[model samples]
Target: MKPLVVIPARGGSKGVPRKNIKELGGKPLIYYTIEAAREVFDDDVICVSTDDKEIKEVVEQTGLEVPFLRPEKFATDTAGTRGVLLHALKFYKEEMDYKADTIILLQPTSPFRTAQHINEALEKYHFGLDRVVSVKETDANPYFVLFEENEEGFLKKSKEGSFKRRQDCPKVWELNGAIYIINVNSLKNEEVSEFRRVKKYVMDEVSSIDIDSELDWKIACSIYYNIIISRNIDSK
Candidate 1:
């Protein structure tokens, strides 16, 4: 099956100005995703979808193509990721005559994901899994979560279950936004598969950092510094 790697980046970043192109560790943050994609797929299968020219250039330098720039409406801060991805898929199908069996998303925000992670997710995705995403076990269990009244100042349990300990509540996973492999036709209208068909590809916390905020950027840098940068390996 043919696999396509897609990277979505918006020019207007409220958290960190030009966040996608911002220097993290040493290279532009987009470089990480670009390199990781290149490692797993050929140049023809990797593409960058961004509204920013700088991002396009950076992606091009890494040998990835910016054949299309995402529209401004879908690049806004409030825009959901599903919109950008669906638009990109439509653009490729109609304009470029490309139809991939699987479309994998490698968000530029999560810079620490490696080529191995991509391969692992793909293995699961091709094994009849509709959707596979990189996830890490959430530290806070939903079983112990509380819900406060929006205005009336009332408090209650968020779910029906109340476990004696967080570990006893079973496992809950959070979409790290690092990687997602989905069937191309499955995203016809931007709605990912229902939770029932969605599968999780477990990743370590160190590799699951999604840098959308200033605070998140700092934390990512620290984690990378300790886990990757300091290890003397050429970071992607």
Candidate 2:
């Protein structure tokens, strides 16, 4: 089945301001995702769904085409990903006279997610599944220290478990906000939030870094620098 990689990058970023095009590790943050997608899929199938003309120009500078600028309504902070995905699908069908069997969402926030991760995830993906999402071992497990206030306002364990030690508790996974491979038919029929037959593609801590705030941006810069330094040392 043919796969299309959709990158949702709007101009109005409240967190870091123009975050999608913001420079990270000497390149626009969105450039990393675009480069990664290009490594796995042809440029024609990789769509950057954005409402900002500047972002569109930046993406095009990478030699990957932006089919069309997304509508203003879908670009809002209040907009949902479901609507974005559907709109891209509709565009491909109506305008390009092309259809994709699978839609892979590679968020620009997860800059560390690379082409290797995408290729590995696709290798594991098989037909008939609802979706495949990348994840990392969560630091907060519901069975452990995580808690929620009850109706009476007393704190209680988020999930019930009798394990005496945190280590003994079952390992839990959290979506790393990296990659999402969704079947087109399933996406069309149901919202991604409602998918049941989902599988997890595990990644390490560094690769799981998702930039959402200023602190996250700083942390990513540190990590990126360390990685580059490490690579340079290894080469020599």
Candidate 3:
């Protein structure tokens, strides 16, 4: 399949300022994702879609081209990911005369998402499927722990179930924001959330970590040093 890898990294980050270029484990946070993507795809097909100059500079250090700074309209906090993807696709189609059949979205926040995870997810994708998105089994099961407030201001289970124990509840999958192998035609027709033929590529909790806050950053660092780095050392 002809695939275009899009790595969207915006400049403005409220939770952790300039998080895309922020150093994590002695490398820029986006570096891990770029490095992983490079292992699976060629530099030509991989695009770092960013609106920040510094982000572009940091990414270019690895020799991967940051083709274009995303348009301001698509870089805002309210900007949707669909627009960003479409915009990147448009650039490749119009400017480079390259049209990709599949779009692989790898967010920079998930540093632990290895090249193997990407390849595994790609293996699960085909032309007929709308998307193959990476997911982790959610801890907050709607049938067991998740709740909602009723009109009477009373708490109620989000989903009706008679399960007495958390383990008895049906497994719920959560989008890990690590990998998304999307059908280009399907994405052009509708938003990702509206896709009906979506499939899940299951990942473990550590591989699913998406850092969006200070607490998350701390957790990611702890995992990186204690688990990821230790494993790399052990493999030597």
lDDT of 1 by residue, 54-162 (tens): 8888877766668987888888778887777777777777887987777899998988898999889887876356688889998866677645454567776566585
Clashing pairs in 2: none
Count backbone clashes in candidate 3. Answer: 0
The sequence of per-residue lDDT tens digits that candidate 3 reaches over residues 1-236 is 98999999999999999989899999999999999999999999999999999999999999998999899999999999999999999999999999999999999999999999999999899999999999999999999999999999999999999999999988999999999999999999987888999999999999999999999999999999899989999999
lDDT of 2: 0.92
lDDT (Cα) of model 3: 0.95
lDDT of candidate 1 vs native?
A: 0.81
Q: After superposition, how far is residue 140 of candidate 1 from its true place, in Å?
A: 1.8
Q: Which stretches of candidate 3 lie over 4 Å from their true place?
A: none
Give me the runs in candidate 1 sitting further than 4 Å from their true place: 148-152, 193-195, 233-236
Q: After superposition, how far is residue 153 of candidate 2 from its true place, in Å?
A: 0.8
Model 2 ranges off by over 4 Å: 232-236
List the lowest-lDDT window of 10 residues for candidate 1: 188-197
Measured by TM-score, how close is model 1 to the native structure? 0.89
